[model samples]
Target: MSETFAGKSALIIGAGQNIGRRIAQEWAARGARVAVADISREGAEETAQILRDAGTEAVGLHCNVLEDASVAATIDAAEKALGPLDIHMNNAGILSGGNPQDIPMAEWQRMFDVNLFGMVRANNVIMPRMLERGSGHIVNTGSFAGLYPFAASRVHYAASKAAVVSMSQNLALYLKQFGIRVSCLCPGPVMTSSPDAMKHFSENYVMRAPGSHLSVMTQQQTAKVLSDGMEAGRILIPTHDEAWETLVEVAADPDAFVEKKHREFLAGDPGRPGITQDVIDSIKA
Candidate 1:
């Protein structure tokens, strides 16, 4: 929101991978003492090394978000290593790509564990502490897919994120009095793993031009956007500015947007939702 970072201690779960790693770097560059946490200690250490190379104070810790003890231990380790936690990024998540109904029960539960309950788990720890201290921020990673359950391969993934959105919204209201802010980053089609599958799925689930796309933004672009958006204390941080237009359009007249989008779906265009596979892939590439 104001982009304050100097002398702040921030813990980012899932800090080993692309988006999480980039966020760590960005925060480190801003002089925040970072806790690069992941399910694997080695991955976390690697990210910490990257931060250390840049001369930032950081520690790598292992925490399985699905387990309460593991999550608690990681939080304690982070606070011990990084000093008091002023910002907590609940970034741990899994992307299960495929039809929802056909997904294995194990996979579906895992999706909820990381994408929804994991977020809640982290927040349950950090937020109470924040409220007690009377000031803090919890940034949750959501997705544009959450906004509309596009008939993508990752239907469960979308549902999980939708839960995150709803949770963050309520938490925002609940934590406002404590001076603790809660925000969710609902970005569209980040260029991550499984590109072809993402593209194939986006064909029907998202809106996009044959070549143009709105869901995919550069990592750096999104990083910058996320940084600014978080600092601004926004509840929903969307990358493409025009995304708000669509959101507003949909909110004002859901029936119309649904009608138009459904028509596109029936016509087999599959590119009228929010993004295209090509756009998503190119952005990732």
Candidate 2:
């Protein structure tokens, strides 16, 4: 393992499993002590155990992003165990799907609480410390849905992620003078667990992009890309090349992109027969 990050420490929220677990492992492999935090204490401990087994310094912590005090306590405990944090990653989020009309306002708030405000809560605590030190890296996990409004099924998730991207970019612009780096990771389809996991995720969590196919990457592959991107000081990192390419297309001709996206939405989902063309058209109007 490279000692590039040796003597450094990373505090990662949502590190129980999936992409979060992989990210914790990635940093640990690169020679950083890691604090693995998650809503599930067992999950966090499991991840920490894995790192320890691999000869890495690690600790498992329970952190509920929904609670302000839980987040504060976790960060405090992490620093006490591993010294000051060199990297703080917010990877806590809930995956949910529903038509825009069907999703209740309460549901929208819940989604925002986990997917958006969770990062906000952490930053509220960590940013001040980083600013005081005059150095730190903040990584926010977003989704490609944030960059493109094509995930018709996950309107709330997309919206929350869009907010994350916006916040991350703005923070990067402001924090540059302070020597603090912010990265927004917008990944496309990723097999965070088993190969079959993607299938389960597709059916339950998000709708596939219309007229575009995505290659699902493994957790390790996604983590490696994030590690490399962070090393290069990239503000925006998309795991899939296709996601980046689509963003370029959208930026180049937004009108065409919007029209194309709506056309796809209007076609309706065959699986979700409740989503009719009329419903989509009405939403557009």
- Write candidate 2's Cα lDDT for 198-220 as tens digits: 21213344454523455556677
Model 2 misplacement above 4 A: 1-4, 193-206, 265-285
Best by lDDT: 2
Tens-place lDDT digits, model 1, residues 153-194: 577777898899889889899889889888788777556553
> Local distance difference test, per candidate?
0.77, 0.82
The per-prediction CA RMSD against the true structure, in angstroms, equals: 4.0, 8.0
Candidate that would win on TM-score: 2
Report how far off residue 30 is in candidate 2 (Å).
0.6
Task: Please state the error at residue 39 of candidate 1 in Å.
Answer: 1.4
